[model samples]
Target: MLKTRTGILLLAPAIVLMVALLVLPVGYLIRFSFYLGQTGVQTSGGFTFANYVRLFGDGFYLAILWKTLWVSFVVTVVSAITGYPLAHFMWKAAKRWRAPFTILVLSPLLVSIVISSYGWIVILGNNGVVNQLLQFLGLTTAPVKLMYTNFAIVVGLVHIVTPFMVLSILAALEKIDPLLNEAAATLGANRFRTLWHIILPLALPGIGAGTTIVFCLAISAYVTPAVMGGSGPNFITTLIYHQFVTLFNWPFGATVAAVLLAVALTVVFLYVRVLSRLGAAAPAAR
Candidate 1:
């Protein structure tokens, strides 16, 4: 009982901070979203569902939401596809080499997201390295229009999220028992067979975790998409920013934020549930 009390005391400040910083703000945002008369910079105190109606009834906003989801999905898929091999290599690497490889994987996180997004611009922008190379190679007579496109957004997001995917998968890979591989070999299983039947099944949890983290980060990403997707149709986060800052429609902006939160929560819940079921079934299948 005394230990329990001490634990609660230690956690009290964090809990209070969470409530004060996160919970209260979200609660206020949700409450403010229901206000009417969301014109220009003025919002009336009267509550209404007009903001939600406007969001759902308009195809433009719906398209933005769909685009956000699509881009996020693509980023997550690309990150997983690319990150898995790197993580596997890291996991299998010699002990002396692992630290260097781990630092390389984590290097992206050390840089500001804004800086990283701009770095992508230098690479993908018209007259940038890609276009310059293409022109030099005579592949194109002119610089290709690469910036301010969905492709650029995906590339930026993949760069931002790949490290997360790698770390998640690496954590999962480390949890796997080395003896499992040896046991599979003892049963006459080849490398491919062992990997397919042993390693992958054990790694599903990591893959799922990485996928979730990447998806969440991609969907909610503001910096990369804003920088890379410039003047393109607004992503949900960008739309929310526009509503709040550009449009000065606080009620409507809050509404968009609420919707984004809902979408993210729904996706995460479903993803975790499906992965949990898959995780439970993996051992039985083996």
Candidate 2:
């Protein structure tokens, strides 16, 4: 117990930082959600579930809420599908090749989101590169509208969140012992069988980690959806932004934000539980 106390004391700074930066702000936000913020002033603690009630009661809000979840699901699934091959490719490469490949995967995260959004606008817009190329190839008579659609939003969000997926899977892949694969081959397991049975099981932990990150990001993402969806196919985040900024309803916006946060946290919690179970059994997996 004394050693535990000492360890806690040693890590007190980090604990304090978490409380000060995260717990405090979250507490404030939760409290703010219950109050009316119409006049730039909190009216009351007034602990009413009016915000929650309204969120559930409104049809438009419900539609966008469902849309947000669907979009996030698509983005996460797409990222996992794409990132698996990339992570596997990197892991199979020689040690010298790993660094360069990792750097490449992480490079996109270096650019600002606003700038990336603009770049996508150029490539995905009606007169953009994709449409231009299609036209040039006689695939289309004119530039087909692509920007400010759900597809464009999905593209941008996937681009932003893919690095996280790759990196997460990379961590798990690096830890896998190559000798296991070799031994499987020694026993006559073909390449596909070895991979599907052995390598895949070992890599499941990383896949879970990647999925958690991807799902969380996709669910709560604000900027990309706002820029790409515009007024076309609205999402929960964009709707929340409009409510807060245009209608001056912070309490309701906070409510929506809190609900979204709850949904994200719930998903992550379930994800971690399943991942932890699978990861714990990894040693016994052969």
Candidate 3:
């Protein structure tokens, strides 16, 4: 009873903060989403499902949502693929090399997102460094259009989110017992076979966590996509910004936000379910 009481007391501040900051704002946003907005102005009217109806009924909105999900998926996959190997290298490196390599992986995170996005523009723009190098190498006769595309957006997002994935996977990898690897080696398992049979299964939880975080961040990213994607691809976050800031349609913006929140929650739910199943199955597989 005393321990339980102590635990509740310790959690009291966080619970209150969550209720005040997160729950209240989400509740208000839900209410706002139900309000009516016309001609870029919110009308003083009762709740209606028109906003949601229009969101799902309209093809443009659906396209934006789909594009957002697709881009986010691409970014997440790329981050996972690239980050996992880097993380593994860091984990396996000598103690002297590990710190520097870990810092290099996390260095980008210290830079501001806006600065990072603009930096990519310099690299990816027509007549930029990439094109210049390619031309010098006689790979292309002319500068390729690289900026203002989904590809650019993916590149920028992957740069921003890869650090998170690396750190998450590294944490999981560090927790794994080195003895397991030695044991597998003794059992006639090669490096690749050991990684496939032992390391990957143990690291699934981290990979899943990193993937979900990167996906969520990528989907909701605004500045990176806006600068890199430009007018080529329209994402849900861009739409929400346009509605709220450009059009001044607060209610409709709120509705779009609600939809985005729902989609993010749905993805998180599915990821957690899948991770739980994988967790349960890992020991069984062994």
Candidate 4:
């Protein structure tokens, strides 16, 4: 009873913060999502399902949702692919050398997100560094149109999220017993085989966690997509902003946010389920 009481006390501040900051705002948004109102400004009316009906029933909103999901998925996959090798290298490095590499991996986070987004624009813009290099290399007569596209958005998001994936996987890797690798090697398991059969299985938790964070951050991100993708109603986040800030349609904006939250939750749930199954099967496969 004492231990339980202590734990509750320890958690009190976080619980209160969550209730005050997260739960209350989300609850209000959900309640507002059902209101019937005009699109031009703030509105109040009796509860109605019109917002949801319009969201699902309209093709434009559906397309935006699909695009958001697609971009987020791409960013998550790219981040995982790029992060794993960096993480594995960091894990294998000498302890003395680890700090520099860790700092390098985390360097992106030191910069502001908006600044990072603009930096991408500098590199990817038509008259930017990339185009200048390409032209100097005689690759093309004219500059490539790289900015304000899905490609630019993916690039920016990947840069921002890869650090999280690397750190997560690295944490899991650090928890692993080093002797396990030696045991596998002594048993004549090659590096590739060891990684596939041992390291990957044990590191599954971190990979799942990293991917989840990347996906959620990518989908809900507004600034990167807004700057890199040109803010043309191409993303749900931007759409939500437009409805609430520009059009003053609070009800519609709230509905959009609610839908996004639902979709993110559903994807995370399914991903966790799949990961759990893989974890269960890992021991048998070994």
Candidate 2 on 123-205: residue-level lDDT in tens? 99888999999999999997888898779888999999989999898899889897998899999999999989988877878
**What is the TM-score of candidate 4?**
0.90
Weakest lDDT window of 10 consecutive positions for candidate 3: 38-47
N/CA/C clash count, model 3 = 0
Taking all chains together, the TM-score of candidate 2 against the true structure is 0.90
Tens digits of per-residue lDDT, candidate 4, 1-286, equal: 4798899999999999999999998998898899966764456678899999999999999999999999999999999989999999999998998989988899888889999988998999999999999999999989899999999989999999978999999999989999999999999999999999989978878988899989998889999888999857789999999888887888899999999898889878988898889879878977
Best by TM-score: 1
Candidate 3: tens digits of C-alpha lDDT, residues 197-271: 899978888898899899989988998888888863399898999888888888989999998898789889999
Candidate 3 vs. truth: CA RMSD? Answer: 2.4
Provide the overall lDDT of each model, using Cα atoms, as 2-decimal numbers: 0.88, 0.86, 0.90, 0.90
Better model by lDDT: candidate 1 vs candidate 2: 1
Candidate 2 at residue 220, lDDT? 82
Residue pairs with backbone atoms closer than 3 Å in model 4 (clashes): none
Per-residue accuracy of model 1 over 13-98 as CA lDDT, tens digit each = 99999999999999988988898645754678687899999999999999999999999989989999999999999999989988
Write down the TM-score of every candidate. Answer: 0.92, 0.90, 0.91, 0.90
Model 3 spans with C-alpha error above 4 angstroms: 1-14, 38-41, 281-286
- Higher-lDDT candidate of 1 and 4: 4
